[model samples]
Target: MPCHLILSKLADKCPSAVLAVLDSLVEPPQKTVNFKPKQDAVKQEVDHNEDMIRSALRAIASLNRISGGDCNLKFKSLMSEISKSPMLWDKYYSIRNE
Candidate 1:
């Protein structure tokens, strides 16, 4: 009946499908740790993976606050990965709650 319930059921039969759908919803950012688009965009060195982890954490925290459900997310790194998809990123960025 609800989206969360639907997502839970979908997660049981197809994990990737659930992930893909979620990714399309939450969306992801492109900037890495150094606040640059690509390797060449920044002059200084940056730990891309570490930055991704941080950003994902922040994103999840925001989601939890907005959703008002203490989601207690276990794997934040996944959000970083989802944010990479162009379709997902664009859709999420464009969406407005109000």
Candidate 2:
């Protein structure tokens, strides 16, 4: 059977389960009001994030060149708290499942 037909049948059989799954699939809206951040703070943060990303990219590229293969991601500890936080974990799982 087609996937939508199967899902409809299952949802008909278990409306609550289907609703729960769908609710989980929906993303929460960003709470940042006036997302255009005020000049200095936003600029600083953007610059910092950009620098970190570039540093990581450089490290990965160098490793790949030296080893002739993809390098392992080595900073799980650095992001563990953020990824495991309640707010972020929910969004992370929702995005991954999608």
Candidate 3:
């Protein structure tokens, strides 16, 4: 099974674990000086990070829906992390709407 599916099932059986998993998945923003020579590599890394964050947000949304929104409190820290980037916040709301 996909990792997200496993996480969703785990969330159903143990909601508290969702927060811990999310904490691990949601990383704080990091500032690094990028050299022109590594711009492509940096862009690739940024894209990969965005994908991971989107996946994590989807998992959180699934958990919230499965728990009938009872899991909102557990998402406080995750949401804050998501809100730091406009792109992520938009993606999160779009996922929630879906």
Candidate 4:
């Protein structure tokens, strides 16, 4: 099963723990500033971070579905954070419409 599905199932049994995991997963990885990175490396990191955010949004949507909208407050808070970046907010808005 996909990680999101597994997490959704686990949410029924331990919502708090599952939410904690999701919260961590939703955070973007920090950029390493100690070295001058290549353009390709920067592009790859951006792509990876985008993918992570998309996955985390999917998981949150799944959780909201399974929990019958109980996750709305958390989702709203996440959306606020996501909205700080126009690119990410655009991605999220598209996903949310799907």
Writing each residue's lDDT as its tens digit, candidate 4 over 1-98 gives: 26655665676777766565554533331111112345667787776655665665555555555443445555556656667868666765676679
Q: Which candidate would rank higher by TM-score, 2 or 4?
A: 4
Q: Model 1: runs farther than 4 Å from truth? A: 5-75, 96-98
lDDT of 1 by residue, 1-98 (tens): 14334444554566555454454534343233224445565533345454453444444333433332223242344445446766445444543231
Models 1 onward score TM values of 0.27, 0.29, 0.50, 0.45
Better of 3 and 4 by TM-score: 3
Lowest summed lDDT window (length 10), candidate 3: 28-37
- Against the true structure, whose lDDT is highest? 3
Tens digit of per-residue lDDT, candidate 3, span 1-98: 15666676777787666655654533321111111233557877777656665666666666655443444453565556557868767887997788
Comparing 1 and 2 on TM-score, the stronger one: 2
- Model 1, CA-based lDDT: 0.42
Please give the clash total of every predicted structure, in order: 1, 0, 0, 0
lDDT of 4: 0.54
lDDT of the structure predicted as candidate 2: 0.37
Q: Give the poorly placed runs of model 3, Cα more than 4 Å off.
A: 13-38, 42-50, 65-75
Q: What's the lDDT for residue 3 in model 2? A: 34
Off-target runs (Cα >4 Å) in candidate 4 are 8-41, 67-76, 79-89
Local accuracy of candidate 2 as per-residue lDDT tens digits, 5-93: 44445445665554444432111111121023446677777766444433333332222233212222322322353355675455444
Of the two candidates 2 and 3, the one with more favorable TM-score, higher being better, is 3
